[model samples]
Target: MKRPEDIAEQFQEAWNSHEMTALAALFCADASFVNRFGHYVRGVQEIVALHAPIHETIYSDSTMQNEVISTIALGDDAAVLHCWSRLNIGKAHPAGPHSVDTVILAVLRLLPNGWRIQALENVTLTNPRTGQPVLRT
Candidate 1:
């Protein structure tokens, strides 16, 4: 919360901890998010709702590592950034143990409390020719 660039680390921590409240606290009340699967939702409550179930189900044993790709300051109160995230999924889910790489684009605003994400979109890395998911190098 000290810096906008730190959001990626915070997200990774929250996700790994499986704490939806902690994750929701990182976003603005009216925040918008689009998951790698193309599901879109607006507002922190909706965001929490969208993620909470998954944490207990498909993503129960998932851990994520996020690396900041770039951060651009839009102004004193706003910024945009991309984070490369690698997710290690556990075998508890139906898909079995697997890994996924995604690029997350986030727009953050300097709220009164601290920096909060206003919008975020996650896209899975895929091979263009094969149209299949690709692991990050």
Candidate 2:
């Protein structure tokens, strides 16, 4: 990646393409992730396992748009970033064709090759009062 901030764009592309291998390449071998539905897993392989099926099923036709909200350098080798993403749910998804907004917090580490995600957490935007998913605020 040319810049640390580029991870969001890479993620967006990989997700839209439904290429789990490409997505796995963006993370470290020991990377950890928490999906919007609260499913947590450690290691890139596990992450791939968790995501691969979804792309074949619920997310087959989904497309995501991600905007980098912030990127904070923790040190020379580490950084933290928040990306706001909007996903257009596919017809195959149980939710049907709908759009959802989410915030993704990712920790990135500058590796020998480049920057890779070390940990990530995704949370869906929701209405606090109604406990319903929020398309937008």
RMSD to native for every prediction? Answer: 0.6, 0.9
Top-TM-score candidate index: 1
Q: What TM-score would candidate 2 get against the native?
A: 0.97
TM-score each candidate. Answer: 0.98, 0.97
Give me the runs in candidate 1 sitting further than 4 Å from their true place: none
Question: Cα deviation in Å at residue 16, candidate 2?
Answer: 0.5
- How many clashing pairs per prediction, in order? 0, 0
Native-referenced Cα lDDT, model 1: 0.96
* Candidate 2 per-residue lDDT over residues 37-115, each given as its tens digit: 9999999999999999989999999999999999999999999999999999879998689999999999999999899
| RMSD after Cα superposition, model 1 | 0.6
Shift in Å, residue 57, candidate 2:
0.8
Each candidate's lDDT (Cα)?
0.96, 0.94
In model 2, which range of ten residues has the least summed lDDT? Answer: 128-137
lDDT score at residue 14, model 1, on the 0-100 scale: 97
